[model samples]
Target: VDVMHAAFPNKVPYEIVYDRVVPSMPEKYKPLSRREFLARVMTTLLVPEEKWCLGETKLFLKAGSSLELEDLIALPDEEYGEALFKHLDLAEKKMAAAKSIILAMQAFVYRARFLRVRRGARTIQRIWKAIKLRRVWRAAAERLLEERRGRLAPKRE
Candidate 1:
């Protein structure tokens, strides 16, 4: 445990000593002192109070208790590395899925816009053709009416 503490200071649960704060207890229970708080933490970890001792600035534990604490704190490197890599792989897969969804939405919007523009162009072309046909029909009708009236009128000197 001392070696682990020396090697990996950050990994050890030393915050309790520095912070001097305990986990929340029952509302009826009074606030606990630092030593009592450390004892409570050890009890929760299945280490009896007899197995550990608290001094002015350090805590001492039996060999078995120290081993238990180390086991709880340190995971095998292989397991830790594998879990981290798996999490990253899963995140990357999710990102790819999200990107594909975004692209599909963009394609859908572009297609809808193109269809709207095409429909408007077709409507304009239809209107133009109708206007041209109406002019030609009107001119033809006027010429026919003039010829019929001339034949029906009386002869002039």
Candidate 2:
């Protein structure tokens, strides 16, 4: 078969790359965007809707996940691209915010470890303060991560 030929020139049909997916589907299955995510997990672990007072319910249907520009061709076009653009903007904001929190956390942990090694009280206070900020951001990020993971994970059929 073509797959076997592609995977290994001399391989049998059964030896082809078995787990291969169509190049397009994986990105479509990306977890929810962080704003939608944070909104979802902020109060209850449930995904949000306008009924929940988070915001308009239309957003659920309108929001973007993690698709690349090439993938958006199949996505529904906004009447004028506004809704889709807004959703994408929100996703980008969330990704940037999440990255910032991660960087802050790395800085905090490395600094704390350095201060501990230095063994100075002033350094300890500053490190602990940084650590506290890190913990808060990390907790927020963890909740988002857990929700995304839960959504993306396979479930019993």
Q: Write the per-residue lDDT of candidate 1 for residues 1-157, one digit (tens) a residue.
A: 6534433222234443324222323332236565665555555455776666665545667555665556533555554334333443465577799999999999999999999999999999999999999999999899888888888977677
The sequence of per-residue lDDT tens digits that candidate 2 reaches over residues 1-157 is 3333333222112111111212222343235543453353322222234222222221121122212221433444432134334454566678799999999999999999998887787888899999999999999999999899989998758
* Model 2, runs deviating above 4 Å: 1-80, 120-157
- Give the winner by TM-score: 1
Pairs that clash in candidate 1: none
Alpha-carbon shift of residue 122 in model 2 (angstroms): 13
Model 1: CA > 4 A from native: 1-75, 154-157
Q: Mind sharing the TM-score for model 2?
A: 0.29
TM-score versus the correct structure, for each prediction: 0.48, 0.29
lDDT of 1 at 7: 34
The lDDT values for all models are 0.58, 0.45
